[model samples]
Target: MVHGRKFISVLTLTVLVLGPGAWAGTETGMKGALADIPADVMGFVCVPSAKALDEKVNKLMQQLGLAQFMPTSLLTLVKEQTGVGDALDEAGSLALIVYEPASPSPDELHNAAVILLPTANAAQLLESLKAGEETDGVRPLSFFGRDQFAFSKGGHVYIGASKATLKKVAASEKDITSRLDPASLGHLQTLDLAVWVDAQKLVKLVKPFIDQLQEMAKAQAQGSGAGSFTAIQLRSMTRSINMLTEGLESAQIGVSLTPKGLGVSFLMATRAGTKMCELVEASPSTDKSLMVGLPADKFIVAGGQIMQAEATKESITDLDALFEAEELKQHCDVQQLGTIRDSIREMLLALRGASFSISALPESPEGLVGLTVVSKVVDGQKWMDNLAKVVAACKKVTQKEEVAKALELVKHEAGAATVEGTKVDRLSFDLAAFTEMEEKEVEEMKKVLGSDGVSVRLAAASPEHVVITFGGGEARMAEVLKLVKAGGSPLGEDAGIKKVSSSLPGKRYSEVYFAGDRLVALLSSIGKVTGNELPIRMAEVNAPVALVSSSQGPCCQVDVFVPMEMVVAIKDTVMQLMGAMMGGAKQTQDDTL
Candidate 1:
């Protein structure tokens, strides 16, 4: 326990000594210094210049209008204590290398990491540390025991578990020459702060531990009915664990501030010939232009190609087995459940691609938000027939008096609406049909769903494609259906989407986009019902966030980012909220007096 606490404390101290924005660094400055660090370790974090990072980050925060919200007094106090602040000021770079423990014990784990800081004047840095011992900064850290735990040699200060570990790292001659890809090295140099994990090394390191855990789970599942459930869950977890560690090659994540915006990006590469890699490999029908027909006014838009329907169906099947366990089989009809599962599998098999969008249409009569879903199927007519069958099955179950009353609460009316000179099937719902309700509640539902309830419309754009709209009324539905049937300026060409396009992969399995400010406003509009007043009127800007997931053979990459304007909008909202709270507190105090 003592060693564990010491380990955590030392890590916390590193952050304090480096000050704010310490994690942001440039890799160009770390070229020669990388030679001292071992490349075979599980993972490592590198910061090229603490002073430079602090300046860069502060400037970014100031530009984003968030500098005022950050608290830095604790950082100042820690720097004053450790004196490593001055040391880092003259340092070229700082690194923390982590290794797999020989055994999963606190002490062994404690010895499994090392810190290296390369400074111009190692002697001056060492003197400052000695000076801190006379003060409060280095006194509490006496357990590190004199100069043995940390020592300076050849322009680098090494800190480790003990003299033995320190010596080993200091003596290590391995460099990160061919260990990292050139592109990865480029990312390291450019990103503000970056972490790279060698997944292959990680798998080797954790294999023994995983094996032990599996065995323990098996033992626990041996003698009871509940144990069977545990075994099934453990089996699922272990499979996922194995896939991540064994099937992945490497992963890198970094926070960056570009001229356009501040965001974090993640890249992952999977190992060749692995099941996970094969699963992510792109298919022929994977469409990158799926978002083209989506409405530009939407607050949220998500479109994607189904990559692994079989895997999804299999997981659902597992759930079915779980529900059918001996101790819990009476809660549902197993036969009907099986039928539903089969129906869902059939639907999954039929799905080729889908896209959906949500918008808070404040300009509409209802002053509400709504959703629109569009799917490109193999056969639109067949899909609709299957959907009708499912709905009929649902209606059959509502014959019971209680069920009938419950169902009546959502009064459904089947109708037809014209779209692009063609009749489209439609179903509209009156949500509060069976209960006495206030006008305010109806308006509230309108505020959430664009209508008092929902309007589902299905339009067969072609024999092969189907467009569906939910919640938005006739005009909105007609507009969406026209876009699908005839090409127009896509959602991808929208200003918000354009802003983050450069950050997204050229090809992707799926993508999602968010109108940040609109989402904030929508949430704020519903705050009264949740008993909280969200500060939505604080910003007058449209900031968008986008996410894309793609795979190039075995390498699968996902990128999520927002432009810098969104950061500023978020900061402004937070500042206004804080001011309001403070004012309320002051008013309360004055009233007491």
Candidate 2:
């Protein structure tokens, strides 16, 4: 068997054999009954027996005066247990023989009552069953003050007020109801269950308003802005009504439908706790109105202590026009500022009440007799300027240093003057200084280039032109030319040069050429050359060529093949140029010789 089952079997055996009073009524009975419960079942057992009893009583109370409360039905459902039957039989016999109040004395009745009280075994059985064990034939007993009574196979458990206690409760309830408005009391009576039935519901009702005010507070914290005190006042009123409802004895419910929206409040009071809940929904017609006061002891319970709570909500809408009216603006003026401050203080007291901690400013300022004013006014860029104008006007009217100091403090505390109006602060890498340094370096390079004979000129050249220049004389420019050739070539080789020419000519020039993939020609000559390698300084006016018949063919050979037509035409042009030059040269030569 499981450990839990084994333990339970052992406990049951011990309890059945042991007599009454062997275990303490509270501790030992609970330990013995719950020792064998599994971890998950322990939750049911660990819950206080009184709490379970209270829940059972509540359930039975709901069934009161209904068809389910019939005596035979109640007996079959709630009281047909072996242990309960035995206890009732014993009590009934004693009542008939010894506690016949009509014939017996009061002392006999008292003795009979004492004997009818729950025995140790009965109490233990009841406690164990209440710890989550199922019971059969449990029923409400009308004789036991009309509260709930249950019977199990093991024993019986009862929950109810005594006759005298019930009378006192009824009387107290009557007293409280008498003071309330008759309409309100009637409205409260219509509720089906107690107001404190669900604490979460009450929290839901008030949370939205609190959340709205808190948002406004956070915005106010960021900077000077218009705050929704009107919203705060409305929420405070709702909280008060909710607290009042939660603390009522009759489980009364009240609902109000104003132009602003619906307001629902519930009140419930019990021996353990009292609670009130009020929920409000804003309507279309709410104006620039404020609820001014609330009760000090709003949510006090039976133990004279306040409950801990968190009240916040997520679905509240904004009341823009209500907080932004011109009349509200007038209320914030300098002359009326004191009234606003006092109103705020009163509103705070109403909302927080005496149940919470509240600190207040002293009645008078110490060491400084200055007027201090606090208000949430308009939000705009010009707010500070307007405030400064007001301070200047006040300074002009008053000569007191305290007034100036007070204005200064307001300006400082408000943090209005320190913020830039339009400019936003931002961080960026500083490239401006780097750019200035670059410009200076470029200027130095220009000066150095001017002093050197070497000139650097940028140009655009085609691939063929660049290759030709690289192969001819500008081999120093091959690096860039080779890169372009490599990029464009399919097979990746330097092709031979085809043509090379310079734009400028007639200057003293040197030739350093390469041919057939090697240096071959490097001569600089002014005279013309013949096919036979004969230097022709000057050609004859009428030149003859010898003719010879060779096996190959009849050939006319000359040191150079100068056509007769080209020689005659050249001689005539040369004689013309010489005749003009001879006249000028002889004239100069005759004078010199």
Candidate 3:
């Protein structure tokens, strides 16, 4: 009654209302609908059989210990809203595609996705949406091929960024799949959760954006619009950007389920001749050193080549031109070094490739934490000698005031400790004694130092290793010896761990291993503390994941393995815990009212 095209509106409505029944045909007609999808796709996530995926999810839910807590009603609502009904059992291949834009937008780029379904389900998908206000906006029947129409058959629902992309794809004789770069698709074919990115193509796509941000960061650093910031900070950001830009060519990774755990095998390539390339080439093959003397009760452990040391030295050319005394100023107090760069440089000279770990002292439990650091050296004796010279030199000049300030609370004294019948330099701090000092006296020291107090016990654990204890009571030979003896039963001796370690190529550079039993017990204990009992105990599902980082050819790879069942159990426990916490919080508020 109102518009210029009332008849057209009526005609459009009739087509949608009347055409659906004819299109809904038999489910059998939906077969092979997935293959019809246009291959030329920027990105696509395919569900070959929704029924299979749904059933698997249901089976997994049943296997979960706290299946009762799952919100089934919510899932049912989602299925109804998404327009994929239980008829999915009869529905064949469904793919959602993200088509690349013909040109990039300067602001708020719009995109489109085409939801591909079986020809039979297109009508059902649209009809399912009719129950709500969703269908009210339908522009259907005005455009399939002639009048820039709103709807089309051949199994696709246009939405958001995919609207135009689908229209273009509809006219093409060949699809993206047929025309895609073989290099990209072949790499993806090798992986379960496959991803293939052409490094050069990605660089072109993203680097300009990064360059603009870098310039902005530099400009902000030069000005004061961003509040408290420094040129040094801006410079650091630039370095980070450079680091991000380095060594990326192509990467391929695969994920698969295994009896041992969820296994991931990945391959990443880095540009040649770059600093990262050199570092990767120099990196040792294994991370065994990190766990060399590790104990099962440890929390965090790490090991890797001393890339920083090399980088520090490499920052300056003609290294020998700078004498020992000049180099001393490079890595200590800014006031002491004259320049921060100098301080960083000197510190680098004494550091090298090493491995280390932190663990609770068996006797003191969590109260006492111990750290063991081991360094690789051609000659342990010579390495210690050079290190001693560096430390002694650092003490005599420029860097001492900074050291004194740092250890002001801890009365600093030089001593020697014998470990394995060898004399090694030692430093001790007694927190108990430090706290007893007069407030006035402490304040006076802090003026020259800082308004903070920290005490640590340090020892040269061995010629090639050092032990630094934050809370472990005795910092002497006996304690250090206990740590040096990486505990038995687990750690270096566990059969499963050893097997995984052995499988990695090259000498071990670094690794992170979680003891299955220990990790399970620790996590389960949290439930007990909160008085929220889990339906099942972690001990029943003993699965361990090992993260091994090592170098392979021109790339670096980290392989991780954990069991699927273990993953499910962990997820269930966490959800239950969160639910309990939320419920308790709500109850507290209710009681307050």
Candidate 4:
């Protein structure tokens, strides 16, 4: 799933992940079921087996603290409603889909469904449903042609929303599979778990709904639950989706358990002609660039590497057209639009490729947090010469008030640092220096202190290279130099990170590393704060949380590596606690009755 829109379909999805045991040790029959589904599905999720998952969940429930009676009661209700009690136990694969809902309010609501099992068991389940054929809302159904097909074909069954847009998938029969092929849906074989999404279909399906939301915003209703979607939020979301789907041609996601932890991967392909793909292709590999000049300490670090040329071009062009739309004319004037367009192009042209990082130092004297957005210029000192003029031209009218206060102070001053035998010049912008003179002096002081006093620290690693740090840190430059000297050995040399990076595309574009011990301690402290009796057992295990991505072909790969041993330990602790609670519950019941 694309993360955002997947959650947006909240009303339609109540997820239950299928287990792996069922998929293993057999040739899956899920393909037969998939054959009956339509092609142009908006959202789809298929899991290996319902039976194995149910077994685990039920055992956990039996051992756990929650009331057992409620689950049983709910199970009975579900059996009655869907008419498939134990049939789920025999399912080869289980899946759900959120497709086109009935008309009127597509943006906020959706319709969904799936009911199936293995061939032998599916017959029994079909019989159960047939027995309740006269049940209200369970009537004879038809697709594009009424009475043209039977509900059960072969050993599988078919059920869909009446208005389901399963566009004539019969022709693509040989190729009618979502990213998760039907035969393999129940099995990733050696892999522990998987998740996939049809990005093209998702984008295709949502575009119309976004347009409708735009129209609704014009009359902009007056309620909260349904029609209350504000234009600003809608516009922003629309733009975001448009931006995301811009270069994207296809997408896939997967989750698998490793010996130490778990690994999750998200992959997306850009259309051949998109600038994003080109940028990805041209991006530098972080593997060789060990020292990015970040702080050498135990901090939660996040960073990215982007080719400026493509990103800037796309952003400027897209945003320019977006604002140029007749609907957004009220927000800006011709002059402002023209200024923004030129600034963006110029900025991108100056920016060759940039890498930036954000970290929570927790224990550092310079500041509790640090942020750096450093862009490499085609000609650093030359660009520095015209920085004020170039940036000043880009400010829209709405932004004037924001920058007016900072405008009074000169933005740049010089400093230098030596990194690995190279002397680097840095331009430091300490906006906090102007805090006392700011109109709202007292308030401005608080804001600056909170925001590291609005400091922008840039280190010119070389004539062509520049590192920009955005917050407070007296030793920030020291950290930057150390980062360059260390060359990010903490991540590049990490075994787990290396493993994950290898699985992804070979061209590493970006990397992030998290201290496992610190994170675990943080979690344990949080539990203590909330008075949670069960402390997370993470401290007992040490593993780095690493994410690295690489560009390959027209697409890129992002892999998240986390230790499975920690996950397993947590599971064991939870189940043990649940068993204790269940025993206590039983004693209480006996005492009561």
Which lDDT values do the candidates have, in the order given?
Answer: 0.63, 0.25, 0.46, 0.49
Give the number of the best model, judged by lDDT. Answer: 1
| TM-score head-to-head 2 vs 4, winner | 4
Question: lDDT by residue for model 4 over 1-593, one digit each (tens)?
Answer: 34334333332212423322211222243344354444555444554544444454454344434335335533334345454556544445554544544432533232333333344464576565443352332334322221211144334444443323222222225423554432234333323334445666566657778677756754452332222224444555656566567767656565554334466667676665665667655656655533245444444454446454555665665555554554334444567656656655565677765555454445333444467655667776655545544444434433355454454443444444454454444333344465445546534333323344555555555566666665455456555655644444343444444554444444576666565555545445434434553433444443456677776656667777765444454556677667888988999999999
**What shift in Å separates residue 161 of candidate 3 from its native position after superposition?**
5.8
Task: Compute the lDDT for candidate 3.
Answer: 0.46
Per-residue CA lDDT of candidate 1, range 1-593, in tens? 67677566446555653434433344666554455567666776666655566566667766866677655544345456656556654446667777766765666656777777666776676676663342211111232332325666666776666555665665667666457665456555666655678887776767788789878876776654442677667667777877777778888876665657755667777776876776655433343565745777756545545435655555676675665565433433445445555665566666767777887665455445767777777777777666655554444443457665664554333336566775677655566554555888777666566663665777777666677776657777777877877764376577777667776567676777777678767777667644576744546455577777765555666667777777778777787778889999999999999
Candidate 2's residue-wise lDDT over 1-593, tens digit each? 34334223222311222211110113332333222121110011111122222233334334332224423322222234222332332111110001112222333222221111122355454453332332343333422122223332212232222232222222332222333334333333322111112223333444676667666655553444334454444544555545554443223332222121122333333212433212211111111111111111111110001111122121112123333434445444444443333333332222210111011111121110111111112222233334334444443433346544443333112331111122111111222232444764443332322221122111112211111110111221233234333333211111210011111011111111112101000110101111132111232222121111101011101111222322343445465557778788998999999
Ranking by lDDT: 1, 4, 3, 2
Best-to-worst TM-score order: 1, 3, 4, 2
Steric clashes per prediction = 2, 13, 30, 12
Candidate 1: clashing pairs of residues: 24-192, 261-564
* Model 2, C-alpha of 149: deviation from truth (Å): 13
| Predicted model with the maximum TM-score | 1
Query: Candidates' TM-scores?
Result: 0.82, 0.18, 0.60, 0.60
- Which regions in candidate 3 have their CA more than 4 angstroms from the true location? 1-52, 66-192, 195-208, 224-229, 250-268, 271-284, 287-290, 295-335, 338-352, 364-367, 378-406, 410-415, 430-490, 495-509, 514-546, 559-593
Residue 49, candidate 2: C-alpha displacement in angstroms: 7.4
